[model samples]
Target: MSDDSNAAGAVEHREVVVIGGGQAGLSMSWHLTARGIDHVVLERDTLAHEWRDSRWDNFTLVTPNWQCVLPGYPYSGTDPDGFMSRAEVYDWVRAYADMFGPPVREHVEVVSVTQSHGGGFDLETTAGPLRADQVVVAVGGYHVPTIPRFAEKLPHGIEQLHSAEYRNADALPDGGVLVVGTGQSGAQIAEDLHLEGRAVHLATGDAPRVARFYRGRDCVAWLQDMGHYDIPIQQQPGGLGKRENTNHYVTGRGGGRDIDLRRFATEGMSLYGRMVDIVDGTAVFEPTLTRSLDAADAVAESIKDSIDVHIARLGIDAPVEARYRPVWRPEREITELDLRAADIATVIWSVGFRTDYRWLRVGVFDGAGHPCHHRGVTDIAGLYFLGLPWLHTWGSGRFAAIARDAEHLGERIAAGAREKAAA
Candidate 1:
């Protein structure tokens, strides 16, 4: 779409502009295209670049193959339970674009998105400038790396990398690697490094864990049957604050393995409590190792009990015993892990991400830098967000669940377009 310009040269305009080319952006595009909405997708890199580059070599979706959901393209592969590697995920995203052929512009980095004096946005891009009547910021949550500032206290001799920058164990320097923040990425990366024979030190607080498979079916299978993904945003336990922190401990390797702090503590890897600070070239830690392990085990037991209850209610012939390895409860571990003394040369921070809204110059964002939206509708008429974690459900940020949210946002955008045209 092009607009007749007065002073800013010939400007390209469209009814809608989606800011990312990942699943969220593409899914939004598919919905917009289906409803005859004219829109463009701007990708700073190739499609699914973050999935291609941000994950490690052994990385796979925690959810199953059947959960590979999209607007029009559902998973048609044979093995629905199988997990996809990084390369395979890239292929899946590429195939989606080929099938839909959404209007996508690659390598066009959006430098800034300022509101025009008129309605809509003035987008300054690396490839020049354009404008759009509606803008959907589907850039996802992992736009920026969130490393603790205290990491700067470490001696330069100690190498450090965030989970986004870490590729594999071999890429790290020699000696033990201190992996901080034992969420999904941290737990997975620690396993990766430890499996690679690198001395591993996992520094973390109490993060809950769950057996990948419980009873006779996968844990996700039970979650799906119980309609876990369909739960509303407000009805969820822990309310809104816990929404940002409930990334569970699980992995997709070896037919969905059960992983937790206690399991890692017994794998010959040193486990420490939360890192407090660094003093005199020594990295200090909190004394919560036992507490962390016990807390994780309690959660795991609770999940297992829930699964058992469901199985009994359904009269399913699933096994009474857990199908995987028994959870390993190591002794009360060391509270302090001396980085230099332990010969730890590399520290991989698997401490989650922050939304990079630097390009957004809108007033709709909250004090936390999160957009204020009602199912992707920001207060500003033409601005929206998609692929946000817990935007609508627990699965909003994931590939298996983005399509539903995208479809909702797409309809919203289309309605806005119709209103503009009618006016």
Candidate 2:
């Protein structure tokens, strides 16, 4: 811990330190305390501020309430069918932190965690410095919005911002709105806007199979009931084994947790296949592919139901039986939104988000701008990472999946601490 920095003098020392105060950071803090380890959590803001601040007003956990619990605590709430709202989840996280009374140094921004001469770390923060024998970086992946470059060429009046910044469709410019990307955020936003009586156009890139709930039942309950939550990741077989580490896929960054895009279509949302170019505020789609995508949605839904069946047979739970729902596709004679024909006020880009680790001057990041690690262990001794998407297992990085990684990493940290103390 450093008392003063940039004064030509600073005190620095700590046995262990965890960077971030979200689920992973809070999880690690609990485990460290369980082992009687002295550590502190350095948070850039109050706990779960991102959940409280960034999420849209109507956003709900795609994973049900049963899956929202953290280690050393259970989610005690009355809403079983009621998907947790953003505020509800944030409150749960804060309560969990307060329960164990983890020492959190809030509002202190960590600039970097450079390796010191002694091989530990010179933790440069806005407030002084902190030296640690071990450090766990739990900064999650949803920090920055990943915006496509093509959007830059659009006219100035056509407003656009990523999903992280979008609160709801009320912020959009008046007219039929054009929503690009068909992943979780895009689909949800398109659905919400269409329901509000706006003429919405969804530009889908690639449509993936999404379950209304995992396996015809609530996905989270199945994970816990079948021990998917506790399954030893090394035992995953076949495609499951291949996808044990989830960072390989380039599809919708948010999968398994978004509303069914097909649902939006069934509910009267206009959908387009692809955006070729924006000509005077009009987005033109490829005619052939545009015609084929609507029919393709049926195949996608079938594939999703198949996965649900498989997941249910894994002994997770009985499969859910529901009415067959169809995908939302744009008609050839669909009504086009003329931003030029009318007033265009705002554009909410429900595209996706990315991780911004540039501030942390560390050597562990890969060329793709992602942290390089094996099971959350970095090559830099004493430096660990957590809550990364698919860090070591299929579920490694998802909110419903992080506890497994947290437990394994916690054991590793605790054993290492014991070894160092014995020395």
Candidate 3:
């Protein structure tokens, strides 16, 4: 090894540089440290700040506490049946870092990570430029919230915000609330506002495939125990791959929680079909799928009952049955002019998230903005990815699913570093 002054006389470099100090980055750090490897973690903010700051105040993890554990620590709270609040999860990640004392440089925003010659990287950050032999891109998938382009032209009275920006019911306008999208976040936000005594209107899209539980257990636990997380991204079988590929409709939160959308339905929750535009205060709905409304409501009832039973058995205090209003057809639709009306106040867009890799200048990403990795191994040598949805397999990037990929990637990087040193 060389002294700092001697090394500076040559060039600045770290052995391995892991980006994004969220759960995935920290998990990788844990494994790297366990193997006695030297590395540094560069974070855009203080560790777990995304969860601490970005998540809504009423937000609780969709997954149960038991399924929330990472590589080095288990969820150690007393409320196993209770869902973990975002603050709790953030604190847990911070504690994990403190206990392991991973070499994390906080507040160092990485502006760009460009590959240099000879399989190295020049990471340009807010602090300054630094070089590293290896880099791991661990920025999460849901960092950016997408709003429909048509929403921009809507009148000022109809407030528009993504689900990420929604904190609670009070964030909406004085009149009825319109929640666009049927994914987990959208449904939960709509339900929260309805319970808070707002006229809630949920705009329907393609409802995702949902399961009340997985294999007679909480869906999350079943995934963990079945080693869904252990399935290598390259080796994931067909079913889970399909499930992951499909949106799985609902949020990742399991049973025994309070995100009961059906309860809101029973309480006069108005529904609308597909949205075409927001002309005035109204979101125009499609008319094609009108015939299937009743059937969809039936399916929703079954889903709600199943959730109620699960929570009841576990003794969790979630409202099981509240009849919500259905605004549009269940099958298809042409358009409705409801959004242009002045009645709707807030529009919560709860659509899914997209991964962004533009900062990574390496040619490792496909056209769809996803990294090209076969089980977390990128095409660029010394560069890798972790905690990506379907990065390896169906369950590769779930809450409990991240540890295995972290371990594997850590080992591969260490081995590659050793081989390079020998060469």
Candidate 4:
């Protein structure tokens, strides 16, 4: 890479530029380097910063360690089925970068990416300007944490934060904790607090749940054997709509297990339906607590049913397992919750995140602001996206399948560079 001073500012030039230095970016870099492509990776923060900082103290990968496959560096840990903790995850990614040195610029933020009139792309960054013949946006969606608008009306004395900001039960103010949303993060975090003996009130959403283990192996192992993870997004049951589906809540903490909100309810963790609004200093919820719980349980059983079919079809010798049954049910609809009366001092919003592509001034986005791409290859020449959920397959956004996606993108990028050179 080289830099030249122009009228606007110092302009660094590269054949290809990659944004974000997480696993996605690093994986892309790995492929690019192997193909002898010259590129620079610009990271807004330190490499693997998300794993190091965003997760809670007790967080672990829902998927087993064996799934962590970068471009070339696969997980070599002894226990393939065991999950890696937050610190271990960070170290793993960092070790990948160290093993194969990528031309990564840490703390250099790419403020904007736009098409250049002279061909290629122009990027405005904290360091200055950059020109690239091709660009790979390795940043996965979920740029901004989403909280309900009515959260502002909550009592000021009650501390509020996004699940991303939550570390542990001790970090929160003493009193009952209200956890909103039942996605993987919310469910696990709620379990984290409940195990710590903190007063926990969980507000559930429409997210599904899955059993951690079934028969004699992890559910994930069964799914993998059944070729569930290998299905392309286009061939998925819901097709592209599957991308919007919330992940089933499960946990890898303490040797991996299922997250049963119903069990939590029986154990004194208050369960309510989705929080709709805060009115008159009171929290209003839909009378869908029972519905949500049933839906989650139903999904979990559906997974087990699929497993049973797979086992029977192959005539495998897996041990027979009993289907899950709801252990507890709501006696009555509890639609209103008074924060003060319930002694709920902390509200953690685990409602998920929103995509922020405001910095991208390209016309490759659709009406929904999602990038218009076919397996990460956008319509616009030399522009691409990587590491999006279901971008090509169920594993597209995850560690298990990123290597394949990155390898494909690397081939596309290299071919594009060759075409440009031939021209």
TM-scores, one per candidate? 0.95, 0.82, 0.83, 0.98
lDDT of 3 by residue, 1-423 (tens): 114415544555777889989999999999988887777888987888888777777677766777676787888889875677777788888898888898999999888988887778988888777788888888866767878889887776668788888887776658877788776677767766766888888776655434445334555554454455566545544632443353434443333433334445556786667676866544677752343244445654565455556666667664334454544323334366555453876778887677677788889876676667777788788899887777766555567667877988988988988998899
Model 2 agreement with the true structure over 1-423: per-residue lDDT tens digits: 333423455556777889999989998898888888878899999887888888777766666565665777866788655567777788888889889898898998999778789767778898877788789999886777877776775667778777777787677666767777766566666666776788776776554433345445544454455555455445755622443222211111133343555556676666666665666665566553344454445544564555566665665555555544554544563333455564545555655676788876778887667777778998877889998765676566666667768888888888777777797
Worst window of 10 by summed lDDT in candidate 3: 239-248
State residue 332's C-alpha deviation in candidate 2, in Å: 4.8
Q: Residues 19-119, candidate 1: write the lDDT tens digits.
A: 99998899999999899888899999988888788888899888898988999899998889988878888999899999979999999999999888988
Better-scoring candidate (TM-score), 3 or 4: 4
Clashing residue pairs, candidate 2? 1-13, 2-11, 173-345, 173-346, 265-328
- Taken over the whole model, the C-alpha lDDT of each candidate is 0.83, 0.68, 0.70, 0.92
| Residue 30 miss distance in model 3 (angstroms) | 0.9
Give me the displacement of residue 108 in model 1, in angstroms.
0.7
What are the runs in model 4 whose C-alpha is more than 4 Å off? 2-10
Cα deviation of 421, candidate 3, in Å: 1.5
Candidate number with greatest TM-score: 4
lDDT of 2 at 108: 88
- Give per-residue lDDT, candidate 4, residue 48: 87
Which residue pairs show collisions in model 1?
A: none
lDDT computed for candidate 2:
0.68
